[model samples]
Target: MRVLVVEDHAFFLLGLVTALTGHGHEVVTAGEPYQAEKLLGERRPDVAVVDIKLPPTHSDEGLRLAALLRSHEVPVLVLSQYAVPEYAISLLGADPRGRGYLLKERVAGVAQFMGALDRVAAGGTVIDTELAAMVTRAAARRAVLSPLSERELEILALVTEGLTDRGIAERLVISVHTVVTHVQSVFRKLDLPKTPADNRRVLAALAYLRNG
Candidate 1:
């Protein structure tokens, strides 16, 4: 797999490049803001792993860049220093496929990090369980996620991990039909409207993570 890494920190960038290359992936790198754009124009990578902090107004530059890349239908996996639910909401926007938002600390878990990158590149949505816990807590505080049953919440968490219906069913040792029933119940309880893109699962999970 080919990956483009956009990170300003040299040490961390080197670590990422080294780790990804060692994982048998072709890695392209850019250390400066906007350099990723140039590389994107030059070569198409399966996925772009970006850091949320960058030079020249080090605030949300990477987030902005991720959004831009999504507009071109590119897959993006964003790494953030904090588990900010709002940031995840903003990054995912309407279309949640081919997107991911994970905590920067998770980079230490090489297997987990690589799995997330592969999932996003394959057109799946993956948010860190830690980040999702943060959002779930926030939503609970606001009483926005109270309507979901314990089982529904469990399924939502799995969905947030980018599991498909069959995967979720297998994980829970339940039938696919049961998983679908629970999923539909979740959407109804959340009042998530269906869209032509068939992204209701992502939308419902996003709503839970975003606190309604």
Candidate 2:
């Protein structure tokens, strides 16, 4: 895959570039948004892996750039240094197809990072489990997650990470049958609202968790 990586931190950028290239992905990189925009137009990469903070203002420039990429029908997977639900929700809320939000630290997990990139490029949503856990914790604070058992809470957090039953089962070292049963139990307990985007069960769950 051809990837456009936008990051300001020199060290992080170098490591990311190395990782992408090592993973057999063609990589184009920029230290800031302007160069990133230039590369985007010139390279026309298959996907973008953007950092939510950048140089100059060091604020939301990366987010704005990601939005522009999305407008041009480019897939984007945003990386952040912190677990901010608002940032994650904002990025994930706008035409979530081919979009994702994950923590910067997750890059160390090469398998996980590669998986997220592939999924986003294929028009899938990927949220960091840490951020998902934050949403789930907030749900508990609001008594929204109170009905779930301990194991159910664990599964629900993974669900927000956009994991399938099989993926969750593998992660928890359990059977897919058990995973399916637990997933059903989770939704049944929470009774999430009926969402128009049937495939976006994660977003629907997030919306309820964040706003409930």
Candidate 3:
């Protein structure tokens, strides 16, 4: 797949580009958002892997780039050292599909990281498992209404990991119906009025992060 990478750290950027290229994927590298935007305007990419922080601003350049890609209907996978849940939510605000948020340290295994990129490029969300748990715990702490059960919280974490109900059920060795019920309970406890198909997950994630 044709991919674009936007990162500020020179070594990290070079390593990622080299790794991706070695994986047999066409890679384009950009040090900042402006260059990434220019590349996007010139040729649309199958996927964009962006760092949540960048040069000129070092604040939210990657977030902005994700928004730009979303507006253009391009897929995006965000990589960051910190579990900045707010930034992840923003990156996915435009379109929950074909998006991902992964912690940089989690990419230690090239095979795993490349698999995540492939999943995002094929229109799937792939949040890091560790970050998902962190966000879930944060949500539990900040929750105002009813509190989530430990089991419910676990299910929610799995949800943020981009697992389908069936996949979650299989992983947990529970029935699909049980998984669905737990998910519903989680939303209700969190006062997430929106349907699961909507962006309620984002709210839950943000709340979790805030509490943390």
Top TM-score prediction, candidate number = 2
Best by lDDT: 2
lDDT by residue for model 3 (34-144), tens: 898889889999999889888797887788878888889889999888876666666667457888899997666899798878878888777778778876665566663
Candidate 1 TM-score, true structure as reference: 0.87
List CA RMSD, all candidates.
Answer: 2.3, 2.0, 3.0
Candidate 3: lDDT over CA atoms?
A: 0.78
lDDT scores in order: 0.81, 0.84, 0.78
Q: Give the TM-score of candidate 3.
A: 0.81
Q: Which residue runs of candidate 2 sit more than 4 Å off their true CA positions?
A: 193-199
Compared with the true structure, the alpha-carbon lDDT of candidate 1 equals 0.81
Winner on TM-score between 2 and 3 is: 2
Better of 1 and 3 by TM-score: 1
Instruction: Count the clashes in each prediction.
Output: 0, 0, 2
